[model samples]
Target: MTGNLWTAREIAQQPDVWRTLATSLDADKPRIDAFLAPLLAKEDLRIVLTGAGTSAFAGQILAPGLSRTLRRRIDAVATTDLVSNPREYLAEDVPTLLVSFARSGDSPESLAAVELAEEVLSECHHLVLTCNPDGQLYRNTAGEHSLALLMPEGTNDRGFAMTSSVTSMMLAALTVLGANPDVTLLADVAADALPDLAKRARVLAEDGADRFVYLGSGPLTGLARESALKLLELTAGRVVSYFDSSLGFRHGPKSVLNPATVALVYLSNDPYTRRYDLDIARELRADLPEGQVITIGCRDDAEEETWSFPGLGHLPDATVAPVLLLAAQHVALATSRALGLDPDNPFPGHEVNRVVKGVTIHALDE
Candidate 1:
């Protein structure tokens, strides 16, 4: 464990934490099935995955892939959005299952989202996945219509950014929602890949880029957002960070590239999407010849410009996203050190918080 900087240690320990969460969830399958069976059996059921910030990105990462696997509609709506305009995102007639993913379980929007769902929808159920058992969402949201799932110990990260907590919650959602969720294979990949990934991130961080851009396609786009946020949070906004879909990058965001910028592209395993990602990577390389463009994927012939994930060929984007997230977390931590910022508390003046503050929930007029 690194002294003072718990972020690096927490990020490095995520693979094992994910494994523990998988095992725990697997053991509780009967209960999970019982809670979800009725809601799933409903012919017209709608599922909304909600959270704040990185937790919200967990839903964003899972919704696209999980929808394909579950053969149902699963939408990712942020708690911030739901809190402000519950009428817009939440339906009154539809039987909805609001899956809440919270790291601390204490975020105001977490509880408010659940309350708003109860008020707006005739039939609503909750599948609360959080790191903190003591959190309001975990304590109050469980009942006949809801079930709360807690991650294994030590996942409640104490740092300014979420490393293990978000990944664990994301993996738990996959295990519970996936059709043939193979936790063992996902856990195995994380354990085997993280050591080298951390090293790669350290080397990249040592290279010292002033601007960072992370690009991904499909489900990886949400991960790009999370990765960019990690850098922005850990560096205390010192490193200018940006993220978008690889295709969307070419529109206008590509201007962020410079000699001191690090362009990281997360290549999709799907051949069709990978084409676009590769095309953009080449363009980024050509556009900023002096800047560093690192491709993170399992490309067989990656040349000299990639951080390859060997033996992880053809893994679904959902499974591979978590590993890439680990790579991003390491990069954020290293970049924080490069800029002489504290990974634990980047801003001593209390600009940002582990849990956001100063938000007052108002009545949503029916």
Candidate 2:
């Protein structure tokens, strides 16, 4: 029972967890570069970013930014879609790069999607980012054409939800696509700032906003989705949650806004994206809701109190504000505890595990 105690304190102190995971990417760069070289060289390369559930959200966070950075046609597609209609998702005419993000590569949909891609596409390359090295995705790619980047150990959380693992895999994808992110610097900043973020998040969680809406543009939208899910899952649905892109929120979703709701917007550093994000913030500020609208970003000249991180230049745009997510996690944990829900096992009757369960993988016909 010695190592069995899974407390937030312990989870927070796991040996430069962020840095270790970040540094591991150094070895992956060359492999990634080699794999991506020919694909990038092609006049028309279609990059499809995919996964299931949270993994799928990782793609949502990265695709837009990656498209802008690499100047390639990148799209985020859920493996669930690939499972249902493989041909529709896979393109055969042009060279393609498939980036699959998974906490546990064993997900039936994850494995099947890979099989489907190879079967349906004449030319396809793969980049697999996962925590489980022994998972099918890693095992299947041995001596093959793909590259699999395994995250630092213990990142494969044993709890019912993914915390560190999700962030780690997302970082891996960002590193491979480009950025050449400095893991050590980003990790140091995150680790140092977490304690304070945790304290503030607890206060917010305790305030008990009836409805929570997360807003962000580009890659941060994925972070917003993950943030909303953490609160929803950790609180066992005690708090209702939703997410939307910054500009898109005004179309209709803004109707949900009221005095009793908490709206969190993740701002971008890019002027174009930030302009839209700030516009929404201005509207929210003008409405004067009784509830709070918190903005997390690197640049914060807005009138409201903003949470800004000073040394986040080493991270990619999608990753820069992730420390803000640590705050969200803390809020979820503290709020769940305050509501008398166990943070470790929020859903008592739910059988979901850290890796996942009850998934049946079928044999692909050769």
Candidate 3:
């Protein structure tokens, strides 16, 4: 934790937190199943995964895979969209499940979106995943229609950027949605590889690169988005960051590459998606400087410079996301320190905030 202080500790503590999350998951299974079984049985159920900021990205990361697993209409709609334009997204006839992700669970958008859903949709059930037990979203979300899941203690990150909070929520969503991945193995692999990953990120962050691009495919795309935001937040806007799907990058966004730019490709485990991810990594390597293109995770990584996840290639992209995310977190933390900023509170002037301020949540009817 010496390198980035509180941010580092939060990042380093993730694997353990993941393990604890898994251990407690079994105790929740019966209750979770009781709540979800009937809702999922409804063929017309429209599941909307949501939150604000990093919490929203957690839903984005889980939506694709969860939809595939559940074979239902699932969407990752941010609470920001729901609050600002409720009528456009909500339908009264749809039997909807609003899965909200929140760290403190108190973000104005978090509860407002849930309230909007309750008001607008004729049949809306809530599944609240939050890190804080006492936060509004968890404390009294919905007496019966809502089933609130609390993440492990200490996941309420003290850092400006979310490290464990978002990931923990993603894992909870994955398990509840029936991915039921081997959490122990994922946690074990992360614990084993995190030290070296941290070192690699520290060196890379200190390399003076002013621009970073993260590319991935499918569920990995959400990971790329989260990675981009982490760098931007930790560096306090001194460094520019962008994220797009691997194939989507070729459609004009590739212009961001330069000598001072580094591209990180989150290789997917899905065979088809991995092809595009690897292709972009190779294309960027030839286009940018020799060491500027780096691949994170998976088997094909041997062909390119990579920050490997030794035992993780066999898992689904959904399971590997949080583990692979450690690299991005460390990179942001190191980048913040290298630029002489504080990771714990990147915007000390309140130009931005850990818990965002000044938002005025208005009545949807008005």
Structural similarity to truth (TM-score) of each candidate: 0.95, 0.89, 0.97
Q: What is the lDDT of residue 228 in candidate 2?
A: 88
lDDT of 3 at 261: 89
Better of 1 and 3 by lDDT: 3
Find the candidate with the highest TM-score and give its number: 3
Look at candidate 3 and tell me the lDDT of residue 186.
Answer: 82
- What overall lDDT goes with each candidate model? 0.85, 0.74, 0.87
Steric clash pairs (candidate 3): none
> By TM-score, highest first, what's the ranking?
3, 1, 2
TM-score of model 1 (CA atoms): 0.95
Tell me model 1's lDDT, rounded to 2 decimals.
Answer: 0.85
Candidate 3's C-alpha runs over 4 A off are 1-4
Worst 10 residues of 1 by lDDT: 298-307
lDDT tens readout by residue for model 3, 63-130: 88887877777899899999998988885469999999999988899889988888888998999888
* Model 1 Cα lDDT, one tens digit per residue, 238-352: 8899999999998988787777788889998888988898899988888775548888886556553378765565677876677778788888988888778889989889999
Candidate 3 Cα deviation (angstroms), residue 179: 0.7
Q: Candidate 2: where is the Cα deviation over 4 Å?
A: 1-15, 288-291, 300-305, 313-316, 351-366
